[model samples]
Target chain A: MPVKSLKKYVGVPRDVVANFHGKQVVYVSWDQHLLFAAPLMLCLPPQTTFRELVDGPLAALIAPDPDAAAVDWSTVQWLKANQPWVPDFDRSLADNGIVHKDQLRLSTPGLNSLRPAA
Target chain B: MDMKTEKKTLNLKERYRLLTRDLGWEPSYRSADEVFPYVKYEGIKVHDWGKWEDPFRLTMDAYWKYQAEKERKFYAIVDAHAQNNGHLNITDARYLSALKLFLQAISPGEYAAGKGFARVGREFPGVGTQVACQMQALDEIRHAQTQIHALSNYNKYYDGFHAFADARDRIWYTSVARSFFDDAMSAGPFEFMIAIGFSFEYVLTNLLFVPFMSGAAYNGDMATVTFGFSAQSDEARHMTLGLECIKFMLEQDPDNLPIVQGWIDKWFWRGFRVLGLVSTMMDYMLPKRVMSWREAWEIYGVENGGALFRDLARYGVRPPKGWDDAEKAIDHMSHQIMLGLYQWSFGTSFHSWIPSDDDMEWLAKKYPTTFDKYYRPRWNHIKKLAAAGTPFKNFGLAKLCQCCQLPVVFTEPDDPTLLCNRETVYEGEKYHFCSDGCQQVFENEPEKYVQAWLPMPQLFQMFDGDVAAWMDWVSLRDGHDNGDYDGSRDQQNFQQWRGLATSNQ
Candidate 1:
């Protein structure tokens, strides 16, 4: 649920991927026109470098969970075909899993207007 | 020590020499003019082809690695920001409106330039232009891609970005850019290089890029600023190529003088018309802070282009034809266009607000002619509405310029009265333009403008249900200003990143 909420906050209206079930993808929309979409597959244990993410055929993992190989790989294939993008499809998968190093603390004082009472 | 090494070095140059000059046999089938007819029609005589020198000396390997690295660095920024939720504390959601205009109006042009430059590379076989065209082509592609990539984050929250790529091809104001570049492409190679490369890139790129980037930085738009500056670094090199090409043509032959001058005149004005959008962006779009359009133009256009033109005059070259129109234009184009955007941008992009009292005062002083006399009246009227707590009306259509394809209603050169009344008739249908240069563009090709499907029409189409339902769209198509940037999701993300950075320290 937190991951799903994070997607909405990053500017991806959930309706876009209502059926995008393969993995959690975090998208950052800038300038109201450009969209950068990256999947969140394996979360890092936290405090990882750029290299640890590519441990194996990371592309294959997103390809078809093998259990779901009957599903279309065309979308994943197209993404891999255009890899090394400015969104860094490779590193994004690792970074998404970062375990929070800090405890969460927040209040609704600033956001009460945007949300109702919990 | 090297008897073998000396022999090998000599052998390499000989082989290259053989391939470049000695290997070519005089054409057995066709005469030179028959083969190179297009270059001659432009009236530029090239006494020496070898005089063309590419300063960057880019080979394939170095170019790809550097370009790829640039993309890597840019993507890393995107990733880091995404993990942390940067830009959650924006002053207001209204700021994204500027970005909406940037995406809808500018990104498609980048792609169009890429396509146009690719064709130029194919058509023009000369190495100098080919290399320049290739770099420009690549630069435009990166611009388009980076723009889309950066803005994608906004799509999760906004409404204006949807159908922007489609709108660029069909929209009315967009025709201003499409027609301008198409004119360059259809013209001779030298004219294409000068009009687009020199006139647009060198003359006004700083004016366009600087404010947009500065506003990005000021507003906490780090990703947008990163992408803009990265493209700008490449633009510096492109500007060098543009300047070099112009100097080369001027020095090549005395007879080449008039043709080059005419192109300079025509393109400078053509390019100037497209900048009307930028003028409005500078003066009105930036929320947190920015230099006004009048100030930027004075420093960049007047000071820079003014100096460059003066230097060119030593070679007997005059300022581009219709320069006076731009001189007149800089006075009031921003004020007028911002007024138009004020009425139209609601519910679609970021909202437009009246200029602050200080900003208006600055405009009055900077644009001594039009501000106090012409625009101040309109601003005062809008201020009255603001005071009444009444919202501005939705949708307005400014009188379109016949030549530049921009809206009319610009103030007179020094008068600010006549409302910049200029018109042209082709096939008996009268067309209006903000300035003479726009009129020339339309007269040059009326068929193009007649077909423009400007924004006013497109908005009507959207309202008429031709487009996807608004506020019911999916991710990446959500558009700008979902109203979350101010301190919700973005705030949470920022605090998290800061905490992580601090804790890691």
Candidate 2:
């Protein structure tokens, strides 16, 4: 469906990768973790390795969750834009096919984020 | 015999007709299409201009007299409320968060409505519609001013009320409202009326207004309550105009049904997204609760809105497409939104806190089905985190829905635990929505949403991606303006002042 307008109507999206000063906006959703409101948006360089994201910014972002320290990355599953993608920890984000504005759903299979014996 | 001819003054109804209905002349030099360029663009065909009616038959002279009387009474109460140190009279300083949110996020929308109505009034070909829109323009501006006037007292004695106008454009949370108005104001005249006048005023105003007014009355905010009372008549007039326009459009032609239905579907969901903020405020912000957001929705949204759609059914109009989803959401929306707010309190102008034990108990009783099962445990996690001296905060920003401009905090309707995330690739740029309803709205009009200056994305792009710079850009004074309600300056001052107001020590 198109916009009902008097003139030509399609517009350039404001959040395209070109506008973000060499960084791509990636959304991280921790499965079953309702505490962090919504997915956290992180602006990262395209070359940042998958391992660096987990140990650095991703680690800091999910630091408040009690389950963060217990996650087994080897067994954890990842979905990028609704499709399953295995994490090559040594590979860059661009190599993993995670582009700008893509949402990566990190589902820890056995690690449900229920009230963790607090 | 030629007797002296005496003239009697025109009656109110006659004067109203003379002033409003009789005040149009067709353009001779320019074509109608040239004169009103936006009228035919949306494809709503109007056969007659005479069908539009103002139920009150209000003329400029009578309108002035009525509004002037209201102003006199309202200002008097405002002055008294200020002079009497009424700031200390609220149920708690915590209640001020609702006021701050109202002023910052919602009052500016009133001003936007005023501007939208004025622009559409000029574009509309019908003289009656022009008159109605003109009158509503004045009403909306008045509502904005009076709301600011009522809440300005709190500015002198509060933390978060200082930069409401600035906050409307710059803050992250308020973009939901600001962008909503921007979307309406930028659209064609017919869509503007459907979006603001009918969908907003007729269908959703009660959910927004009733809670604030009744909350004010219940919480002892005399100034806010007085403003609410003063705006009551104008609100009624606005509602009448909304209903009249919707009915007129439906009656104009059979071709308009789909167009009108599409708008109703779009704006109802849009309005529902904005109301999610109000739902949180009603449930969590009020110190002395009037009713839970769930109760208010059942009454105002489901009950009153049901009767309205039933009447509209005669015109072959059904309820909004998002109506059933909204019903299922009432149980969980407030809790989800409040939890988000509590965690993200670090970024907001208003204070947020974990609900007290009593407050949680109230919530548990109100939402017995979902609260304990899904939300209560989350709050308990946050509570323990705060008690351990590291209060939880989502330090990063959130991705916003392109259409509604709200963060995608809402969850799947059936599963309370999973976030309801919807996205589509429009012109190679991916856009996200919080629900199917919002997604459908975006898919219909990709052009308008693509240009939306989303605050979060731009914060990184424009504000050097620095937290302090973003805070400075948004006019938040770090520690003072943002954070938890407990131990904040607002709390300390209220407790100390209330002590001084009552005690001899």
- Indicate which candidate wins on lDDT: 2
- Window of ten residues with lowest summed lDDT in model 2 chain B: B16-25
lDDT of 2 by residue, B1-505 (tens): 9888777899988887788644678789999889989888788999887777667788878888999999999999999999999999999999999999999999999999999999999998787788779989999999999999999999999998999888998998899999889989988998999999998998999989988899999999999999999999898999998999999899989999999999999999999999999998898899888898899988988889999999999989999999889888998888888888877787899899989999999989988888888888888888999999999898768878888888898888887778888989977888888999998988887887888888889888997578789888888988998899999999999999999999986
Candidate 2 accuracy as TM-score: 0.98
Tell me the spans in candidate 1 whose CA falls farther than 4 Å from its real position: A1-118, B1-37, B89-91, B346-350, B356-373, B386-390, B394-396, B443-505
Highest TM-score among the candidates is held by which one?
2
CA lDDT scores, all candidates in order:
0.58, 0.89
Query: What clash pairs does model 2 have?
Result: none
DockQ of each: 0.01, 0.69
Worst 10 residues of 1 chain B by lDDT: B470-479
Residue B156 displacement (Å), model 1:
2.0
What tens digits encode model 1's per-residue C-alpha lDDT throughout B131-187?
A: 667877988899899988887776664455656665465545566676676666655
